[model samples]
Target: MKIFNTPSNSSTISGFLLLGFPCSRKGQILLFVLFSAVYLLTLMGNGSIICAVRWDQRLHTPMYILLANFSFLEIWYVTSTVPNMLANFLSDNKFISFSGCFLQFYFFFSLGCTECFFLAVMAFDRYLAICRPLRYPTIMTRCLCTNLVINCWVTGFLWFLIPIIITSQMTFCGSKIIDHFLCDPGPLLALTCKKSPVTELAFSTLTLVPIMILFLFIMGSYALVLRAVLRVPSAAGRRKAFSTCGSHLAVVSLFYGSVLVMYASPASEHKAAMQKIVTLFYSVVTPLLNPVIYSLRNKDMKKAMQKILGM
Candidate 1:
């Protein structure tokens, strides 16, 4: 068992390296450009969505408030990894300090867990709005939203604290090369000399349970929502309800589908490559897409964007 310690005291880990995709100089340059483009779009799209929600009073519904939070979270999430990753792609020497690696892991996991909880809260909000429209406002008041946001942060931090501590415990005496761009548990665990099944199990359980439970709640809520929508007397009313639910459902599918395929499945022959893509999707693509999906399909957000853009 590894004894956890603070970064300074944890036996000075000399160098942090990466075991990212093996490519030639030309390929590396191509990847750098491609990722740069994606990172820019992620920032612009999520940033615009957050600004649109915050600056417009007309868009100050529970739905858009959650949307704003989601967009903001996505912005930070992508920024956490993509910038460093881009820098690494441009150079052969991918060395991060021990403290830098820990910090990267800390922030990335914190934001990732927060996003998971936020998605659940968003799903619950939608359930109230759709399945119990009359009670929506009373059920999801301003205070409730504030509480929910606080809970998300607390939950993420508390859950991640263990892994961070356990990671702090491990001594990286052997190889310092991380298989991915960021300091995720998968690659880090592989490098450690000490056994870490307990830590790995704990981290897996922490990430898996909330995600699974939240997904189940989302599924059940949508089922009820669909039932309610089907009973609406007018076709247009039903159409409207479907539109709202459809967008969230699509996002849920994309987020969880990629997660299960890339992470949940048994360790694969292409674990390294798959892990990279999966991490990219979960960290970048999903967050980027969340704001885009929520805002484009939402009428109020569209109007808010128009106002913000001076149209």
Candidate 2:
């Protein structure tokens, strides 16, 4: 119902104000230090995953290879927003240049979309490994894995190109202030002077469908895996099957659980501080928690890590 009323060039690229946290100076400094530490640890965690996958030939299989790529994606994904968020915490201006804002918007969503595709592919990998064990080796070959990885990156980056460009071109009026820390669609859309239903619908549809389809695909993959494990009959077989699939399941649950929480909230009731907190929580899982979960269950991975680290 908000009518946009600005008389500026829509294409001129007026900058954005990121009103992150409205805290005192002391609180801001504390937050900066905390975020920096978390960012460093995230780098270390994700970096370790890539190095481990590359160093250990034993881990050169489709699953670990995908994981390494996912970790690499996380490195860029977290970097897309966290550094800028950290900077905003310190600066009084808190102004992001028009180009920088759009760039951040593009990379943040693109990388996130890539992560979704990667997760779906990983689910498919588990399905092959568990449900179709005999055929998995031949089917999930190195070349196929490489191709899948490439597809995820290309499709994800291209996914929002049209919608994002359109949304960016919309005439944002009034204060030009974004309440949240990142350049999320909801916040960006809210800043528009007039309500553009067509743009909103397009953005929502483009964003929602892929995520929903991939989520459904992941669920089906795990269901098939669970069914296959249940059919094993032998207690030992079932335990082995559960052990093989447990980590992936945990990662999927953690990732999607956070996502659902963040998105399910009504846009009308969106709280800036809360949204920022949820975003931080959601982003933290990728670089900091995912690889840890993936490798935690594998004794073989531990041995490989020790050998790789000369420990």
The most accurate candidate by lDDT is 2
Mark the 10 consecutive residues where model 1 has the least summed lDDT: 1-10
**In candidate 2, how many Å is residue 261 off?**
2.6
What is the C-alpha lDDT profile of model 1 across 1-311, one tens digit per residue? 22333245335456578756668989989989998988888888888888887778877777777777777777888888888988888888998877778878988988877877887888888889888889988999988988898898788778778778777667675567788889877778776666667777776776677778877887888888888898999999998888787777878888888766755644433478778887888887787677677767877777777677778
Per-residue accuracy of model 2 over 183-235 as CA lDDT, tens digit each = 88888888776798877887877887888899999999998999999899899
Listed in order, each prediction's TM-score against the native is: 0.90, 0.93
Count of steric clashes across candidates, in order: 1, 2
lDDT of 1 at 46: 82
Off by over 4 Å in 1: 1-13, 266-270
Please name the candidate that would achieve the greatest TM-score relative to the true structure: 2
Model 2 regions more than 4 Å off: 1-5, 8-13, 264-266
- RMSD, one per candidate, in order: 3.6, 3.3
The CA lDDT of each predicted structure is 0.78, 0.83
